[model samples]
Target chain A: MIILIHGLMLIIIGIWAMLTRKNLIRIIIGFAIVDTGINLVLVAIGYIKGKTAPIINDAVSTAQGAAAGMQAVDKVVDPVPSALVLTAIVIGLAVTALMLAYAIRMHKTGRSLNIDDFEEQKW
Target chain B: MIETILTIVLAIISLMAAVYAVLTKKTLNAIIASGIISLLASIMFLLVSAPDVAMTEAAIGSGLTTVVFLYALKHIKDRRSTHDD
Candidate 1:
């Protein structure tokens, strides 16, 4: 419950940042915050109290050989969420870079970082 | 019991940094605060038993991202200065 709230609160703050901020780079920072918040929430969901990591080890009782690794399942936290977050983090970096590039080009053309300066269309 | 308390404390600190980063007027200050937010978050990830993710976050999120932002900000500043002269 506490973990969930922590993650959700960060997300809310990120959204607020993106909404209230005027600078293009600040908006990008807000986007990164949202990405981090989602990653935290996903990892929080995968945690199991008092359990070890998903690695097969002696403490997890793999004594029956590699084929009996299933026994370790109950003793460790989930790996799926961790893996997913890894991919998601990389994607977020790429997206942030792309956004920054766009901001750079906009600044070059307009001599301003304010998002409102780029507004030409009335839609 | 102790771990829970530590986590709660860390969470509050990071959240505050995030809020400050968003609300700060100066772009440089906002960027630095956001970097601190990522640094603190990586520490929290370590506490949560995700060392791999923590390392990745510290490397890409805090390190590379901040460097890129600094570069871009410097470029913008230089361009504006040259334009004035």
Candidate 2:
């Protein structure tokens, strides 16, 4: 239940950020919000009740007489999302840095931050 | 049921922030409002068990992005002029 609420909240925030902010930087911030929301939803989907970390140990197999050891391994949380999130984080950083750098260059060339001021490109 | 209600409430709050950010005239205010939107989203991510994402969102999305935007803001002049119509 809590998970569902969290997911819904994330979606709402992301959509909102994407729609309304006018400044380029604000728009980028909106994209980040959307990214975070999506990551949240992905993690929520992977969650399991009463799950343990997925790890393999041969000694545990001998101690638990085989059956319990296999069961323990089966109960672990999914590792795929964890791996994906690491990749996403690095990507997010790179994109944000690039966006900020672009914003800086735009400021230098145009001398104005307003989106409307950049209309020279439209013609 | 409780979760549904919470979801609805958060949705409403986020929507309001979005609308406000859009309607606001000042670019700086809009940027600040967008940061609020990112912060809320990060919290939602944490609640959903994506702590790694939440950490990145909090640090890069809300923190570094805000700083960079402010720096850019400092370099550029606002379009509105005191003497203009």
* Candidate No. with top lDDT: 1
Pairs that clash in candidate 2: none
lDDT of 1 by residue, A1-123 (tens): 466678798899999999988888989889888888888899888888888767676778847766557688778888888888878888888888889998888889988988788778446
lDDT of 2 by residue, A14-40 (tens): 576557555776666667555655665
Predicted structure with the largest TM-score when compared to the true one: 1
Distance from true location, Cα of A31 in model 2, Å? 2.6
The 10 consecutive residues of candidate 2 chain A with the worst lDDT sum are A53-62
Error of 1 at A118 (Å): 1.4
lDDT of 2 at B32: 78
Query: Which 10-residue window in model 1 chain A sums to the lowest lDDT?
Result: A61-70
Candidate 1 C-alpha lDDT tens digits along B15-81: 8898888877898988888788788778877777777788898998899888888888888889989
Fnat, model by model in order, equals 0.48, 0.25
TM-score of chain B of each: 0.91, 0.78
